[model samples]
Target: MSGLRRKLLIITVLLAAVMELIDTTIVNVALSHMSGNLGATLEDTTWVITSYAIANVIIIPLTSFLTTKLGRRNYYIGSIILFVVCSFMCGSSTTIWTLVFFRFLQGLGGGALLSVSQAVIFELFPKEKQGVASAIFGIGVFIGPTIGPTMGGIITENYSWPLIFYINIPIGIMAATSCYFLLTEPVIKTKVQNVDWTGIALLAIGIGSLQTVLERGQTEDWFATGYITLLTVTAIIALTAFILWELHIEHPVVNLRVFKSKTLSVAAILTFITGIGMFTSIFLTPVIAQRLLGFTPTQTGLLLLPGAIIAILGLMVSGKLLQRGVSPLIIITAGFFCFIFFNWNMFRMDLDTSAYTITLNLIFRALGMAFLTVPLTMLAISSLAPKDIPQGASLNNMMRQLGGSFGISIVNTYSARRVASHRVDLISHITNNNPLTIDRINSYTAYFMLKGIAWDNARLKAMGMIDAAVVKQSTLLSYTDAYFMIGILFAVTLPLLLFVVGGPKITAPKVIVSDH
Candidate 1:
């Protein structure tokens, strides 16, 4: 490939990957708009998010096999077309279920974009420059989700929510066109092996059940609900069967054997933790700002922009250091500390905190993520044979997604329990015997009575108001407790860095091959 052609291919892949990732978080701000427009309850409308996530997790680990089965170039172009068409359908839908269906289809197409893009980027670079390749790829992975809500807020505010999905049409078409003209299938041919129908079935059952349970567990009140209980059992049975089937199969869909590599094992574990920390923090910060501190969607999005910029700078610096022979372990250590610092700062957040305080803390968070992401990317694929890179990347990526699901579920459950606990504690302090409590209630009742409310009603309203105040305080305390929990998660993981082996010390490989 000529320099110009290579650059174009690289650009195409990166843009496609960014488009997919951006869509993942973009709809977050538009949920309320969607609810009103479609006349669906907030609970039902949440399926819009859950459906897409379920589709994404199911399709991600299947990419490596799917790519080889369909030609790489063909698969890439097809996925883009699927995404574009689904984007149009998603925008044109009149009903909520229609939109959810289209979003799920879009996710099926979008899932491959990230994993395939990572493989292509890695393939484009020589082995010794894998670290640099990871850095380049890291920028898209990190920035896309960060910028997604911002873009969605701008579009939804300036225009409408449908435009958010519609916007992907033109970009997707262009990317597909570029892939057709510029991207090439590897010359090395893979054997036309039997399709692992059983494996695919197991994967779909396992991952789909798992995602549904996680996404709906809180809404359904966990295992107390029959549906949640059923899904949980299904997930366990399907996932266990999937593992056993994959390990025994001649041509496994996901190639579970890749875990045999010690480096890959450690990298996958770390990637899981990184996913938990990254997604959990992202999930919490915006809710904290909007629900507690009263930030607009745009304001919340902009608050994290500075952190994204800092993260980009960290990526560039880390890339340079890796090129100059800095050990991966040291960089990872620095990244771990950066993550811990950000989480620790989050613990200090309160209702009255300023935007600048959160922004500065997020900068450290972004910097920490930049450090872990690139090096872990290197660590995951570094020891694998060239042909196994896709499988390895798929597995790692899937684990990361699962980690995010797990983290979100765990945090939600913890916050709910903590809120109840704190509420009880706070209510105990509001007894009639307490002088301050009595005075506060009396003052509120007097104000209500003066506003033309009957005395009896005013006293009842005052008590209700106090109850609400207690709930709000408890909620804030629960958020703080969750932040501390995340901080401890990162802090504990920092020491595990000593165990990860560094990548090989060598110059760039002269030739690269991709097995299609």
Candidate 2:
């Protein structure tokens, strides 16, 4: 393929990938609008997000099998068409359930956009330049979710909620039309005569149920909810059975044997850990800005923009360093420390902190992730046999997605518990016998009295104000605690870097071929 066509194909795939990823978080800020417009409760509207996530987790690991069975070009183009159709349906739906159903369908297609697109990008470049490919793809991966909230906020605030879903249509159509003409089928195809029906069933049930549990667990109070308990048991059983069945068969759907490569295994684990930090920070920062700092959705999104741009520079610089023979292990180690520093700085944030301070801390986060994303991609599949690369890539991507889910769940539950604990401890010090507490209440009462309230009523309002203050302060403390937990998690995982040996000579990806 010529340079121009290669660049066009890369841009086409990256656009599609970014569109899919952006959809994952774009609906978040619009949940209230969706709830009001659809005549549903806030919780019901959230299924729009949860349903899509469940579909993504289930379908991601199956892409390698689907691509082989359907052919790469056919599968890629088909998925894009499906995604576009679903986006239109999602936007046009008048009912909540209808929208959720189509969002789930969109996710099924979105999974291939990520896994297959990564494979295609890798195939576009030569063996020695795979790091550049990873860097290029990393831009889409990192920036897609980073800017999603910003775009969603802008669209939702200025227009309507449907615009978020509608926006995907034009981009998806463009990518599909481009790929249909430029993308080619793999010349050497592996035909599957006997489909792994059992593996597919178990995988869907296991991953789908697990993802749902993670998405809804904190909202439903974890295992205390009956369905959460049932789903947890079902997930454990189904996943264990799926692993055993896959390993026992001659041709498995997911190819569990790929884990035998030590480098791939270590890389997968590290990716999982990285996903925890990468996603949890994105999840936490916006909430802190909007809930405590009095920032609007657009302001919060704008706070992240500078860091997102800096992240692009970080990605390119790290990619060049890799091309110039800087060890991935060294790059990855540096990424960990950068991330640790980001967490530490964020942990020091208080209610009085300014947006500029938070933005600076987030820039460190962007740099850490930029350094990590490309190097990790290069490391994961570098040692794999060319034939196993797709399966390896699929598994690696799935791990990252799962890690994000787990991280969000853990932090959500932890923050809630800490808030309750902190609130209780704070309230205990507000007894009548405490002079400072009495004086604080008196000052509040005087402030209310100055507004012309009677003494008795002013005292009551003062006590209510104290309660509100306790809850607010507790929440703030919990957020800082959450940041510290994220930092400590990274600090503890640093030793895993020691286990990463250098990957072997890299081979070009075998999954894609250009029809020039």
Candidate 3:
């Protein structure tokens, strides 16, 4: 392949990957608009996001099987076409159900975009330039979600909510068309195996249920809801059965055999830990800024932009270090320490803190992630054979998403509990007999009276204001506690790094022969 064409293919696929990734978080900011426009309750409109996530989690591990059954080029192009069409359908839907259905389809298509796009990118580069290849791909994986809210906010504020879905139409079409003409199929040979229909069903039920429990657990109050409890049981049973079933079968929808590799095994563990931090930070920081610091969605996204650029630079620099023979282990360890620092700094943030200060802390996170993302991903499949890399890659991708799901669930549950606990601890000190409490209540009463309220009304209003203040301060304390806990969580996982040993980076021969 010519250098120019190869770069174009890379760009084409990266665009598609970013588009898919962006959709995962883009709808978060537009939920209110969607609820109003679709004539649905806010609670019902959450399906727009949850349905998509369910589809993504279910289809992801199955990509290797699908790619093999369908040719790589065919599967890639078809997924793009599906994604583009689904985007149009999603945008045009009037009801929440219609939108959710199309979003689910979009998720199905989007999973392939992520799992297979990286496979193609890896195959395109030579063994020697794999680091550079990973650097480019890592940008989309790490930055796409960060940018989505920014883009969504800009569009939502200026245009209608549907535009969020419509925006993907052109980009998806461009990527699909380009891949059809420019992308070559990588020639990985394997014998035709019988379809594991039973395995497929088990996996879908298991992973789909698991994702639902995670996505809705907090909303439904965890195991309290009947369905949540049922789904939890189903997920555990189905997943255990799926694992046993796959190991026993001649053909499995998702090949668990990939985990047999020590390198991949260790790398997957590291990737999971990394995913928790990577995703939880993205989830927490945005909420903290908007909810506590009073930044708009657009402002929150912009706050992340500088850190993102630093991350890109970090990715490039780390990739170069790998090419120049720096030990990946050393780079990864340094990244963890940097990440720890970022989390620690975030833990210190208060309502009075400036955006600039937070931005500086986030830059540390970006740089650390850049160092970690490529190296861990490269390590995951480095020791696998050419043919197994696809399965390896898919498994690693699935783990990252799984880790993200777990991270979001954990953070939400923890923050909510902390806020409630803090509120109780704070409110307990308030009593009619306490001198400071009485004086504070009097001050609020005097202020309310100045607003022309009756004495009794002012006193009532004063107590209400005190309650609001308590909630606000407790909320802030909860977020800070989450941040501090995040740093500690990542730090505790540092011992897992010991299992990661050096290996020759896997590089496939020219599996892709140019058709032209």
Candidate 4:
């Protein structure tokens, strides 16, 4: 390929991958709008997210098999087509369940965009230039979540929520057309002799059940609910059985055998842990903006723009350094430390934190992510044979996404419980017997009375104000605890980078095994 065509192909796949990842977090700010428009309760509306996530995790590990069946270029184009159609259908949905159903299908299509795009981009460059490929791809990887909320917030506030989905149609079409004409399929030497329907069934059931439990665990009250318990048990048993079956089967839905490659195995672990911090930061920031800082959705989105801009340079720098043959572990180690330091700084902030303060911290977060994105991705599949690259990419993407799901669930549960605990502790200091507490309530009552309120009404308002304060303090404390935990998480995972081994440079000649 000429330089112009290669650049265009890279740009095309980058957009495709970014679009898919943005959907992973875009609707977060629009949830309230969706609930009001669709006439669904907030709890039921959450399924819109859960359904899509469940579908995404279920289809991700199966991408290699699907690519084998359809051919790489065809599968890529087909996925884009499915995504575009489903995006339109999602916009047209009038009911909550209808939107949820369409979103699930959209996820099935969108899931392919992440892993397949990485593989395609790497293929565009030779082995030595793969770092540049990773650099270009990593920019989109971090930018997606950053821009997602910004775009979603802008769309939801100025227009209706449906515009969020409608916006993808044109981009998807262009990407699909360009890829069909530009990308080539790799030749495969061996084919799966038999299809493992049993393994596929077990994987679907297991992963689906696990995702549901993660998304709904807190709302369903975890093991306190029979259904939650049932899903949890089903996930455990099904996953175990699937693992054992895949180990012995002639053809597996996921290529678990790749785990035998130390490079791929450690890369998967690091990627999984990175996902927790990466997604959770995106999740928590918007909530903080709306709930604590009282920023509008658009304002919150704007606050993230600077970080996204800075991360681009960070990605390019890291990629260039790696291309010069710098150790992958060195870059990863630096990223882990930067992320931990940033998280700890966030833990120390008060409610009075300025937008600049938040944005500055986020810029560092993005930089940290840029460092991890390219190296971790390259480490996972760059070592594999051309035939195994697709499978490695698919598995790596699955682990990262699954890690995000697990991270969000855990932080959600921990924050909820911590808020309750903090509120209790705070209430203990608010008793009537305490002179300061009594004086504070009396002062609030006097302020209300100055507004011509009756004594009873003023006292009631005073109590309400105290309750609100308690809730606010508890919320801030919970956020603090969550950030602290994330810092510790990064620190604990840093040791794994020591054991990472990069695959040797590719020297084998190419073989064509495409169905085409």
Q: How many steric clashes between backbone atoms does each model show? A: 0, 0, 0, 3
The lDDT for every candidate, in the order shown, is 0.83, 0.85, 0.83, 0.83
User: Candidate 1's residue-wise lDDT over 1-516, tens digit each?
Assistant: 877788888889999999998887778777777889999986567677667767777888899889999988998899999999999999999999999999999989998898999999888877656766787788888888778777877787778999999999999999999999998886455664899989889888888887778767776888999988998899899889989999997888889999998888888988989988877777777767766787877787788789888888888777777777678888888988888888888887777889999999989989988888888887888889998898899888877776766776678778888999999999989987999999989999999999999999999999999998898889888988998898898788777776674445422221122221
Ten contiguous residues minimizing lDDT sum, candidate 3: 507-516
lDDT of 2 by residue, 344-443 (tens): 9988988999999999999999999988888788778888877788889889988887787677667877888899999999999989999998999999
TM-score of 4: 0.93
Candidate 3 residue-wise lDDT, 1-516, digit = tens: 887787788889888999998998787667767888889986678678667767877788899989888877899989999999999999999999999999999999999999898988888866666665677778889888767777776787678778889989889888988998898777675655898999989988997888778767877999889999999999999999999999988788888988999889988988888877887787777667766677776777777788877887787778777776677778889899998999899888878889899889989988888888888888887888999998999999888877776776677668878999999999999998899999999999999899999999999999998998899889888888887887898799887777764565432122122323
Which model scores highest in lDDT?
Answer: 2
Tell me each candidate's TM-score. Answer: 0.93, 0.93, 0.92, 0.93
> Candidate 1: lDDT over CA atoms?
0.83
lDDT string, candidate 4, 1-516, tens digits: 777787788789989999999998888778778999999986678677667777777788888888777787888899999999999999999999999999999999998898788877777767656666666677777899778989989999999899999999999999999998888876453475677788889998998888778777887888999988999999999999999999987678787998888889988998988888888888778777777878788888777788889888777777667656677777888888878987888888778888889888988888888788888887887668888888888898888888887787788778888999999999999997999889999999999999999999999999999999899889988987898898899899887887774454322111211111
True-structure lDDT of candidate 2: 0.85
Q: Which residue ranges in model 4 land beyond 4 Å of their true spot?
A: 1-3, 501-516
TM-score of 1: 0.93
Candidate 1 error regions (>4 Å) = 502-516
Instruction: State the weakest 10-residue window (summed lDDT) of model 4.
Output: 507-516
Q: What is the Cα root-mean-square deviation between model 4 and the actual structure? A: 3.8
